[model samples]
Target: MNRLMEFIATGFYSGKLPKMPGTWGSILAAILLYFLWPTNLKFQLLIIFITFILSVISADYVAKELGNKDPDCVVIDEILGMEIALLGLSADIKTVFLGLILFRVIDIMKPPPIGFFEKLPGGLGITVDDAVAGVITNVILRLIGGLL
Candidate 1:
């Protein structure tokens, strides 16, 4: 059970990477997820939903164990959020680049309701805020893709 908890907490070992592990894990996961799956809207949305649900549930315990408010090692939320932002978008270099920038901006900025979710207790607070940011980024990406 202990090992199981750690595995989930660290995003199946991606969180354990040395130096900026969470960010690296997220980027790796996003890249793999983008390539491994069919580039379909429904598939991308499904991935986003699953990642969000799993991240929300697991993030709290991970944060508690790490003794930090959203520790850098607990970046499953970022991975899930980044995937969400890229959902249904073109997989071209330009599109992916924009998605990355947009997601990072929203995640970092945490404007309005996204910031509001950050105040919640435990892991819910930690993960949900990023989830909201991802959603916001997703909306913007969809809009930009439509315009282009």
Candidate 2:
């Protein structure tokens, strides 16, 4: 059970990658989203909700085990964030590519409310900032989509 949670928190070991594990997790999310993410908004919301629940559970477990808050290796947050970022957008290459980039940039920057959410404590803190970044990215993507 611990191992299972660890595996999930680690983004199936993608988070173990030496470089930019969150980025890797986001990329993995993109790949999974291509196949598994539903086009229907309702289904998308359901998936996001479920993923968020799993992310919080697994991330909290791993963080406690490792004695670290917001450990880099627990990147289920990135997966959740990526899902939110791409929500409702057309799954076309251009939209997805833009979403990936936008989410990554916003996540890295951690500006404003996104940064604010990082102070929440426990897994919620670890994850919500990225979720906020995802919301920001989604908005940006929507604006871009409208433009082009």
| Predicted model with the maximum lDDT | 2
lDDT (Cα, tens digit) per residue for candidate 1, span 80-119 = 7777777666666666667777877777777898978988
RMSD of each: 2.4, 1.1
TM-score of each: 0.80, 0.96
Model 2, range 1-148, lDDT digits (tens) per residue? 3889989999998999998999999999888887777789999999899989998889989999999988899889999999999888777777777888888998998889887888898999888999999999999999887887
What clash count does candidate 2 reach?
0
Position 48, candidate 1: lDDT: 75
Positional deviation of residue 46's Cα in model 1 after best superposition, in angstroms: 3.0
Q: Which pairs in model 2 have colliding backbones?
A: none
Distance from true position, residue 3, model 1, in Å?
Answer: 3.0
